[model samples]
Target: MNKKILGLVVSPGEAEKKVNTLIDMIPCALKEVSQNTEEWQVQTIVDSLTGSAESINEIFQKINAHTKKNAWDVTIGITDLPIFHEGKVVNADINEKNDVILISLPSLGWKLKKNVIKQLIIKMALTISESDNDSNNKRSPSFINIFPRNYKSVRLKIKETDSFHTRFILGSKIKGYMRILTGMTFINNPLNMLQTLSGVLAIGFTTGAFCMAFTTMWQLSYLFNGWRLLLASVSSILGMLAWITVSHNLWEVPSKKNRKKFRKLYNLTTLSTLMSSILIFYFILFLLFLLLSVTLLPPSFLGQTLGIKEGIGFTRYLDMHGLLLL
Candidate 1:
């Protein structure tokens, strides 16, 4: 029987054609090496039993045991395994004693001498969702990808490697296998739940401001013949000003930490505005709208229409003046 090399991939879901492509590339890459090394040939290729880490390990263990007892000189590499814990992708490496698993690529054959590379392809070769019917191979998703969210990763470092922070592979060493995880998962910090909550709040405040402005200017004052139009105008102006000065200002900051803090503050302000009695809020909004209009409306028209210098009506002004005396 020909000696076989097994490349195992653990993924989020069903195996796709991209996995097959990666397998095809392996043999071509390894053949270019000097003849002195083991004249390896890829015999049988297998997709593992399941999408779990334990399944991957079981398969590798079985292969190792079978190969070892037979002394078949078979080489096996396991990669593209997704290990998801918590909400982030953790990088773990497979090593055994001092022997490292080789990432057998013809280009980086130097690094493959003693390192095991957890085969990861960031770009996908093909991914077709249900709704999409683009059968052409060009439209497919990546052939090589780890996973979407924070999932599993392989983390390993060589002492003399220049880019220690970047991903690399090592060859098998010593006897048994060793797994290493540095406890780091995401490249960027994880988003807080509170950040999303704040966005919901800001949206509510802006919407209320617009609705109140419209009601005060066009509906409430004309329907009731109310003196509260001035008040409505004032409230509208204040709300708009508050949105621009306080709410808008707070949300635009670059730092996620600071934006989160401001978002919480604005959320509270919006809630308090909404909690007020509906009738009272309407009146307040009307006053703001009227106040803003007066800045643009003519004093002459105010006097002709309402018998006042500004937009205030004379009877209401005198009544307020007389009440102050009483």
Candidate 2:
């Protein structure tokens, strides 16, 4: 299939003025071509954004003339713009295949940038794609359903099948949290803080479980010397604690201001979590290494040792318990 070219028609003037000109022209153009008029039979106006009927006619004439020379046909259609009937506006939906324009013609009160027109055409055509899929009624594998699905285009269709559950799970929980913290109670089934808490717990539990497994492995490898495994266990516990503290702080922030505050705080929180975990782990490791050195080294080395072996053992026992039970 050929890739689509989205185009915009800016009407050769300042963007704001052109947009305003289009907005003013729409209702006026509709007025001239009402059911009482001879052009009433026309179901839609293909090109019209400016508030001028003549300009619209001229555009059609130009298209007709072009078709005669190039032997190429271009179909066009127009629809009502409900939101920006008259306003300073930015059409975020405008893109290469979605064109938007401003016009002054009475008949063609508004125009789309050529690309906006193309997207509208494509979106209309996709209705048939849905019907085709409905006829087949095929179901994808479970793995394919793991990611998000938006039936807008072929690109999205492919991506939906390719992405992993990790993304979906993360996104779903985030969206759920947004709904909950915002007090968006209008939703019949809003995501609650409880669910967000559950997701965080699940993540912490998984981390803790992995740490326990690693500790077990270290216990096997070093035999009597489990300082390395103890270190990992302590780090994991600290990481979980930091994660929880930050997440709780985030959850407490009111949603109205959270959007603005989050960008800065989120980075800090993430960095703090990493640094805190690393520092805690290494600090423990240093203490453990010193205590072990006291036993392994000569009597002169005992003065250099900072931690007692009893303290290291007690801390490891506590870290391991906290991690596994978390």
Best TM-score goes to which candidate? 1
Each model's TM-score, in the order given? 0.25, 0.19
Q: List, residue by residue over 117-219, the lDDT tens digit for candidate 1.
A: 2233211100111112244423222212322222223344434322222122222311101122210111011122224335543554455445433423223
For each candidate, the alpha-carbon lDDT, in order, equals 0.32, 0.31
Which window of 10 residues has the lowest lDDT sum in candidate 2?
Answer: 81-90
> Per-residue lDDT for 144 in model 1?
28
Candidate 2: tens digits of C-alpha lDDT, residues 1-326: 22221112222222323333444333334334332231111112233233322113333333334334433222222312111111211111111111122222111112334333333333322322223336552212222221123211111111212321111111233332332222112111122333444554456445544554443522333233346556765676676656766766633444543333333334343444344444444344445443543444343322224233433434444333433432
Model 1: CA > 4 A from native? 1-16, 22-24, 35-38, 47-81, 84-92, 95-326
Please state every model's RMSD to the true fold in angstroms: 19.5, 21.0
